[model samples]
Target: MKRLLAILFFLAGGLAAELAHPVQCTLITASGPQQKRRKAQ
Candidate 1:
């Protein structure tokens, strides 16, 4: 019984950590002068 409880606790902690992190995304504009600089370099 004690071993089973310990296993459950370990699994729960792992799942909690996994759910804590969230995804992220960022966007950049591709307007005229910015596009020109990229091509020039």
Candidate 2:
């Protein structure tokens, strides 16, 4: 039971990291379009 709990904890941590990475990348991508719009003005 201890081993199973440890594995689950490890998986949860990795999944959290993976999810955060994509969200950060998407925010940067979304902001880039606005920067271009501002520069045009």
Candidate 3:
């Protein structure tokens, strides 16, 4: 029972990390072009 709980906790952490990564990447990507446009202006 303890082992199963541990495994579930680890999997939940991994899933949260996987979910957060793309949002960070998209935020960076979304901001990058705007910064460049500002510089150009």
Candidate 4:
């Protein structure tokens, strides 16, 4: 169906964007753990 294709396309675009800026993704992921550690402290 057209809607399914559109949803798949949207997901693919998001993945491509994430891959295009791996450093940003890494920074985001890295910050999450630090925030959790801060909360624990």
- The candidate scoring highest on lDDT is 4
* lDDT tens digits by residue: candidate 4, 1-41: 99999999999998898898764744444434343345555
Q: Which candidate, 1 or 2, would have the higher TM-score against the true structure?
A: 2
Clashing pairs in 4: none
TM per candidate: 0.50, 0.51, 0.51, 0.53
**After TM-score superposition, what is the CA distance of residue 28 in candidate 1 from its true location, in Å?**
27
Local error of candidate 4 at residue 28 (angstroms) = 9.7
C-alpha RMSD by candidate, in order: 8.9, 8.4, 7.7, 5.7
- Could you tell me how far off, in angstroms, the CA of residue 3 lies in candidate 3 after the best superposition? 0.3
Alpha-carbon runs more than 4 Å astray in model 1: 22-41
Off by over 4 Å in 4: 23-41
What does candidate 2's lDDT look like per residue over 1-41, in tens digits?
99999999999998898887754554444434343345565
Best by TM-score: 4
What TM-score would candidate 4 get against the native?
A: 0.53
How does model 1 score by TM-score?
Answer: 0.50
- Go through the candidates in order and give the clash count of each: 0, 0, 0, 0
Candidate 1: residue pairs that collide: none
lDDT of 3 by residue, 1-41 (tens): 99999999999998899887744554444434343345555
Give the total clashing residue pairs for model 4: 0
